[model samples]
Every structure is written in C-alpha cells, then in structure tokens.
Target chain A: MTATLSRIELMRGLVGMLRDEAVVAGIGNTNFDLYAAGHRSQNFYMLGSMGLAFPIALGVALAQPRRRVIGIEGDGSLLMNLGCLATIAMVAPANLTLVVMDNGVYEITGGQPTASAQRCDFVEVARATGIAHSAWAQDTSDFVRLVQAALERTGPSLIGARIERGPAIAQPPRDPAQIRDRFMQAMGSRKGFGA
Target chain B: MPSDSAWAGVVLAALRKHDVRLAVYVPDKVLIPLIDGVHADPFFTAFTATREEEGVGICAGAWMGGLRSILMMQTSGFGNVPNALASLAVAYQIPVVMLVSERGSLGEVNVGQVWSSRVVAPVCDALGIPHQTIERLEDLAFVVDRSIVQAHATQTPVVLVLSPLLTGGKVFAA
Candidate 1:
C-alpha cells in the first residue's frame, strides 16, 4: 500500500471534515500540525504528554455520547502506551475515532527510530486489542475516507496512517488553562453551566 | 462486602454526592469493595483499566467532556502515572479526584510497596497536586467532599490518600 502521506495536509483534511466535534491531539507533531492547520476551541493540544490522546478521547466519548470525538496519536508515543489500545477496546466507546500517524520514527525527539520502524503494524495491534473497526490507510485519500467512515459509523474506530517524518510545522499555545477552558467551553462542558 | 468497617462505602457515597459518574481503576486488594460497589451501581461507569496511567488519561478525558471521574488505585499504581498526571491531567488543568490506597505504612510487610508509598505524597506535592491522607473513619466524608470540590473549583487534580489504618490494610496470610 502507498502510505506516503503528508501529516500537515492530512490534519487539514481532518479539520475540514469536523463540525461541532471534539479532537484531542497527542504531544509534538500530531498536536502541532493540528494547531498549524487552524486552532479550534474543540481542539485539545497536548503540550508534553505522549500516548494519552486515545485515552482522553475515550473519556470524552464516554462523557458525551452524542458528540463525535477524535483522538490523534503518533507512532512513537503510541508504542509508549500500547496497552491503552486494549483499554479503549474494552470500554469500546462508540463515539471515539482514533487516528494514529505512523512515521516510523520519533520525530520530535531528534528522529530516533521507533518500533514501527521494525515493522510494527498498529492497525493489527488495534485489531488484536479488539477494536474491530481498525484499518490502515493506503494514501491520504484513503485516510480521509476512513476518517469519514469512522465519523459516520457507530464505533470506536482506529485509523492508522503512514506519513513522512519531519519537524512539526508549528507549536500550540503553551498555556494549559487556556487550552482546557476553551475546549470545555466549546464542547459545552464548562463547569457551573450544567454541560 | 469484604470490609465491614463501612469506610470504603463512605468514600463511595462522597463520590456519588459529588456527581462523579465514572470510576476508572486498576484493582487493588484494599479497593475491591469500593470497586465492586461502583460496578453494582447503575448510575456510575466503572472501568477496569489496563494500567494506572490509562486510568489517569481516561479520567482527564472524561473531565474535559463534562463528566466527573475518580481514579482508584494502590500506591504502586501511583508510580506508573507520573507522565500522564504531569502531561495530561496537570498540563490540561483537568480536575481529577484520585483515591489512592496507602501501602508501606502501618506495619506493612511487603518491601515492594515501601518505595512507592514513601514517594507518593511527595510526588503529588511536587506536581502541585493537593493531597490529604485519611487515617480515620470520621475524616473520610470531609476529606473526600472537600477534595472533590476544591479540585473542581481550581480545575486541578487532587488526591485523597486512604491510609491502611482507615481501610484495614490488606492482610497477609501465611
């Protein structure tokens, strides 16, 4: 399969397809590219955390079952917490869509080779972990198609996209409180408002 | 059902009163009764997480989506969540209420539990998380209630350390 896709353009496509939805991006390029695409109140940008976007998305999916929640994670970070896939599969929150960007290297940490470089298949991992709606995107178009399907279907889908590794195009705002407040307000989950 | 002291029940009651709908946990011998209670309740979502950090991440996510969540784990599990706490919970300023069962104190026999138990409090402190160790049954409600409120109000995580003295620590048998 042709997996050579641009992470930034892929993020823009995902962002374009979103409306009244919540997205949580992992630390480094996954978040940075999302920020560079365009910042949204529904977008939660992780500043330093790795391997948590999926869990956070699972939580969001559980909290707001009606809202479509998307989690963006990178290959290196995902490997750091592979067991979370099992957790996600166990809970199986149908509103969640996990998008794993596989570039086979730790792009943010000076481009160290990750386990994905050794032929680790994240889609297979997700499938084995009991996420039935898991697949690999052959190209950018396929990635968008899978994301669209995940958004439309009732499932906690895992979409693994192979991308070209490089430096992040931009940086998200470093203020954690601001990020939380904006996301909460946008999702209508702000405290005291009965969201 | 295992513990007749009603301390863990009191903690669960406080969680319910605070509108906590989700309880993400890694099972501990000391927390089994509480976990069982949460599972039996129809109003709550009790999840058995693969790892403690996964529970933290789930709790943080649940909070962002407008759900109040509590994470219950043993002291050893606390050591596994520093990155999740620091990056996701603390960095996002997500208000999480953690119920950690104390170990390595009150005549604890296990050497494995000692190090994590000693450092759990300091770890919370270093992360700017407000924590209180409950050693008495009478202090349960007050600590649980206040910590939940304070955490939500500040949009930060809080810890309620359950002393083995209060929950009648896991009894080792020969």
Candidate 2:
C-alpha cells in the first residue's frame, strides 16, 4: 500500500468544506484530528465508541433528511462494523457521507496492524456494498474535490482516503455529555439542557 | 384482551401516541407483525439493520437529531450490543429505546437461544439500562408507552422484552 496523504491535512481539507454538516468522528486518531482541525458544536466526536460514527451519522441523516452529515472512521473501526456499510446502503440516505481514513493500522493504540493492513481496499468494498457513490482520494486536492462534491450531491457517498499516520494534533474534549449536548444544540434539535 | 400476535398492534399504537418514528430492527418470528407494521406505516423510517450494534448507533443518532427511535432485535442479537449501548448510548445520555424479541426461555426449543436469553437481563442491569419484560397483554400498553416516553425524558436506554407467554413463543417445526 503506497500512501502520501497526511491525516491532519486531510482533516483540514474535509472540515474546510463544511458549513453546517454534522461530523461524527470515530474513536481513533480521526477523533483527535477532527477536533484539532476545528471544533464545531456540529462536530460530534465519538471518542469512546469504535465503529459507530457511520451508523450514528446515518441515523442523523435519516432523522434530518435535509441536513447533511458526515462520518469519519479509521480502518480499524470500519473493519469492526463492516456490516454497517450494508445497513447504510439499505436506507441510502441522500445526506450522509463517510470518509474512511485508511492508514492500514490502528495508529492510536501503538500502531498495531489492522485487518485492512493489506489486501483490503475499502473503496472497492464500499462500492460493492452498494453505497452508490464511492471513490478513493488520490491526493489532498482530489480529497477536497470529492468531499465538496459529496456535500453538493444528493446520494450517500463514501470516500476512501489512503493516508500515512502522522502526529495527532490533539484529542477532542473527553466529556461525552458535553459533546452530545453541544452537538444536539448546534443541530437545533434541543434547547438548553436540564432546563 | 389482545391476543398473542395482536400485541404487535398494541405496541405500535403506543409508538404512534408517543411519536417514536425511527425504527431500526433485525427480526425474528415473534417480531414479524411489528416489523411488518413498521414497514407498512409511512410514519416510520423503518429499515433492517445488518447487525445489532449498527442498529444501536442508528437509534442513538436519530435520538440526537430529535427523533424518537427504537432498535429491535432478538436476544441473540443483544449479545452484540453491550459495548455500543455502554459506550455510545449510555455515555452520551442518548435515549435509544430497544425492543427485544426475547427467545431461549420458557417453551424455547432451541438450545442456542437459552444462553443469550439468560444474559439479556443481566447485561442490561450491568449497563445500568432500564429493562422490562412484558409477560401479559394487560401489562403491554403501559410498559411500552411508559418505557418509550420515560426513556426520552430521562435520556436513558431501555430494554423491553417480548415474553413467550405474550407472543405464544416460536415453536419448533410447527
């Protein structure tokens, strides 16, 4: 697997294209990079649960059909719930986008090899799983163009960005309740918790 | 009194009363009517989850997006959900109402269903999720309605089991 993209650079590129799209980042290096790029109340860092970013985003997109939602997951986490890909394809929410940060390793827990370390190309897997619009980001500029197109489109899209693991800038706030509350408020789904 | 199968209708009525619209499920024989009902009803955004944890995540996200949601699965499937329930639903205080078609208990024929059935209650208790078993038709409406309504009010996940006594149980080979 040849890689040249940086995780943070890709994060900046992805986030830079968003206005109010809700981002659900999986519990991995993706979580840290999302917060590091720019913390938005709209960004819900799923900092503890692995493999849920896509499912959660699917739910959000289903509930709010007009609002776009994006989910970022690592190769390890996406591998954990590969079945979710089929589920997302079943509902096929037009407002959902998923970016699998395929570093081929669990870069968080000391860089252990993931099942996707070799012989697993998730873009092909996702395309086979019927995500309709799936592609690989050949470079950072291509990543931006793909994501920007995902935002403007009306189909569920999956972007597989092959990247090299680099220094994680920072971790999202470890407070789960605070993360949920802020994200929900930003979506206008709730008002002033506990009042 | 509602008959064994009519319990699905009873629960569906409660869902409508409470306005719970997002329905994610993987079904068994006992859940056929309810699952079918959800699919037929235009009010629900119903779909089959390929796996239980995926359903849990969807319900939580739907809740966050201001829709009441339910994840329906068999006891066997519940075995796949403790981590998701604990880490995402519980930790984030997202109320994901869970509907379980509990197998492997009284009148159960399959040996495989027993272990998962026996563990569901303990698992919910361990996760600090409120769980209730509906054994009779009389208890059906109240439990289903209150569980859904109160889960949202408290922002907690819940497990509602459909007992064989109420559904007549899935029998072996006709």
Candidate 3:
C-alpha cells in the first residue's frame, strides 16, 4: 500500500501518525517544506539557523520527560552540528528522535554536496555514539516502517531517510512562524524562560 | 573581606561547592591564572579542547554522562562558536557553565575581537540563553555561584562573561 508514495508523502504520513497517536508533543526544523507540511503537527521551523533543531528537540524532550520530541533534520544541517548526536547519546534521552532527510546535497544552499558524502554514514555514526537505535531508509515504505519502529523503542534513535533532491516547495510564511511561536511558548513554560 | 586572592579562592570553592567535577577549556591569555588554579585542584578534572566549540560539545556530553561540567574560552573563541552554542548546548538544554574572558572592550587593541564581542550579548539574548557579565574581581564569586545555581535549576547553558580586569590583568607578573 505504501509502495507508490514518495519520500515526501511518507514523511507526511509519519508526521500524521505521530500527531494522531499523541506520541510526539513537538517537532522542529529549518526547512520550509517540512515546516509547512507539518502545520497540523504544529512543528517549529527555525528560520535563521542551520543546525539547531536537534539540540532544541533534545531540550524539549528532557524538559517534558513524559512527551516525545522529534527533530526533522536535513543532511547538510545535521552535518553542521554532528557532535550533537554524541551529546544526545551521552544524555540518553528516551523520547528523542532525529530524522535526517538525506538528499546528499544542501538543497537550500543551491544544491551543494554536503560533507556527509565524504566524511561518514550518519546512521552508523549515531550507533557508534551510543544511541540505542540507528538505521537508514531507502524509500517511502521503508521510512514509514522505520519511523513506526523507532517510535515504539526507548532511548535516542537516529533515522536517516534518503530523499530525492527536488525544487524547493513554495510555502506560506505564516505556517512556519506560527509553529515556531507555539513551540517557544511550550518551552517557555518549562521552568526558566520567564521564571 | 576577601582580597583578589581570596576571591579566586571563593571562585574555586563555589565550583567544588556546586559539584562541578568536569571542565573543558581552550587556552586564553586572560584565563591563565584561573586555568592554573583549576589545574592545581585535584577535585576537578580539566581537559583542554582544540577549539571553543569542541569544548562546548565535550562539556555537553560530559553533563549528559552524569558529570557536571563547564567550558572556559576567550571571547574571540566564543565568536567562532555560535554553531556549538545554538545547536548543541541550547538545543539539548545541557547545563554548561561557560566562563568567557571578555576582550576588545575598554583599552582594547584587537579590531576583530572588538567587532564580534559587541554582538555577543545580543546573540545570547536572542537565543533565550542567560548570561551575566563580571568586571570586578569582587563580583567573580557571586557571578560564578549564581551561574552554577542557574544552570542546574534550568538545566540549560549559562555564560559568565569576564572582563580583563576580573579575569586578571592582561600582563602577568614577571
């Protein structure tokens, strides 16, 4: 049933599943397509930065121990902050999920090849860093299955989903900004921002 | 009343008092005295990092491993490391105390340090991280103690910006 869906479609499906199950309380990223498509899920889009989504998700997960936090990351973005995986592993937050959409290029920056192409395999690096579960997805069906499996497991999980490079999607600015505000509001209540 | 040496003694005491057992630092001309003091203390385990951001990442990992940790670097190093602070430390809510020696301010000489140092506070503020600036040696003990307290309370990174006067005079006694 899932064979016909594209990577984008599968990602939408996974976001829907996570939201419907109430498993994920928040999602965050820098990509507009991911942010716009994730409106229903209320995902946070980090507009100004390149590689902060994973660490923000980590903080959220740690603060709300009862809730799940997912970071929708790009390969280029993840490469910029790869050391975060080791930090995540050391903390071993059970509710954190890092999903890296690997198109092997920095789409936002004019389709340049990222350092990941030559340096290392992100999933294997995650495993080596002590994250409990790490794996890659070749297509939509595999992505759905991997995400579902990761959601059920404990400890930090890194899912590298290989995606086809394409033109950037035209998205409304409102969706991304709204989600960012909502997530910040949620984080602000956690103990420190104003208190 | 504690003199400069006494203040330094209190700064050391607060570190131990807060159970900050792990420290990562990148050498800074201004931080030489404090670094030397930290090295002399057996209660603290200190490692030197190649870059400021590497120290931030290592301290984040150390914190996650049940060790309380801090990072010591210069203001110039801080300018080179927004990626580490915004992505790894802020994102993960890792309670890392960054002891930054402020440069290029009053009596400044380096042009590059002056430019980036000006943006430090605004950048930290925009990221929603907390920071305190200390210019007097007398304020060191209070600032360091509050930093440790706030870091643990929020489980987030905190910065203590030390001016040249507070960190110690730029030129060491010959």
Predicted model with the maximum lDDT: 2
Q: What is the lDDT of residue A93 in candidate 1?
A: 82
What TM-score, over all chains together, does every model reach?
Answer: 0.96, 0.97, 0.62
> Please, what are the lDDT tens digits per residue for candidate 3 over residues B30-72?
6766787788988887656655665664565345434577688
**How well is each residue in B1-174 modelled by candidate 1, as lDDT tens digits?**
124659878987988898999999999988888988999998899988888888888889898888999999999889988878888788778888899998887778899998878888888889999989988888889888888999999888988888877888888875
lDDT of 3 by residue, A1-195 (tens): 112224457567676676522122212223555544565433555543456566556545654556666777778877777777877787687877888777677776678897766666888889888886888876776777888787777888888876667764544354433443344444443222453
Q: Measured by TM-score, how close is model 1 to the native structure? A: 0.96
The numbered model that scores best in TM-score is 2
Question: In every candidate, how many clashes are there?
Answer: 0, 0, 2
Off by more than 4 A, model 1: A191-195, B1-5
Error of 3 at B123 (Å): 7.8
Model 3: CAPRI class: incorrect
Chain A TM-scores for all candidates read 0.95, 0.95, 0.81
> What C-alpha lDDT, on a 0 to 100 scale, does residue B143 get in candidate 2?
95
lDDT score, candidate 2: 0.88
Model 1's number of clashes is 0
Off by over 4 Å in 2: A193-195, B1-4
Report the poorest 10 consecutive residues by lDDT, candidate 2 chain A: A1-10
Report clash pairs, candidate 1.
none
Q: Please write out the lDDT profile of model 2 over residues B1-174, one tens digit for every residue.
A: 234578989989999999998888987888999999999999988888888999999988988998888789999999989889889999999998988997998778788888878889889989899999988998999999989888989999999998888887777775
